[model samples]
Target: MEKPWTKSVTLALEGPGKYVTISNTTEASWAMIEDWPLDDAPALNRALDICAAAVEGKRPAEDARKAFIEAAVEADIEIRE
Candidate 1:
């Protein structure tokens, strides 16, 4: 963990989804985006869109987060186990 800035960031990928976590002081939260089949993973697309928007300053990070949560609920993706 040479990069102190990345200490609070967590990125994980699973068979069912991709995860992105960011925070400060080593405390963070994760957003899980469900990964449906490549041919029809609407959730993943929306998730990526939100991610891009949030990073690009096109949308508020919280709004982007809401989008992901909504998508996850719609897809019935299990985020927290």
Candidate 2:
């Protein structure tokens, strides 16, 4: 079976690599924003990969969130004040 939210995820690379946005276009839409730092590209890629795996049922959503959070921490992306 297919995952409902799989189709809602989109990737937007901005301004010749100024930033990246991974958005969920569903009714309960949400997004993950990553600013350009070049080095952070791998972290973003890792998070996206985890999300894809979760959508495919190869991984759990909680695991995905953990991976994403770790990526953000490794990238030093200040997501909260």
**Tens-digit lDDT track of model 2 for 1-81:** 333433222222233324433323111112334343344367666766776777666876665665565565565554431
* TM-scores of all predicted structures: 0.44, 0.47
Separately for all candidates shown, the number of backbone clashes (residues 3 or more apart, or on different chains) is 0, 0
**By TM-score, who's the top model here?**
2
Score residue 65 of candidate 1 by CA lDDT: 55
Q: Write the per-residue lDDT of candidate 1 for residues 1-81, one digit (tens) a residue.
A: 311232233333343456545442112113342323233456656766776766666766665555555555565655543
For candidate 1, the TM-score is 0.44
List clashing residue pairs in candidate 1: none
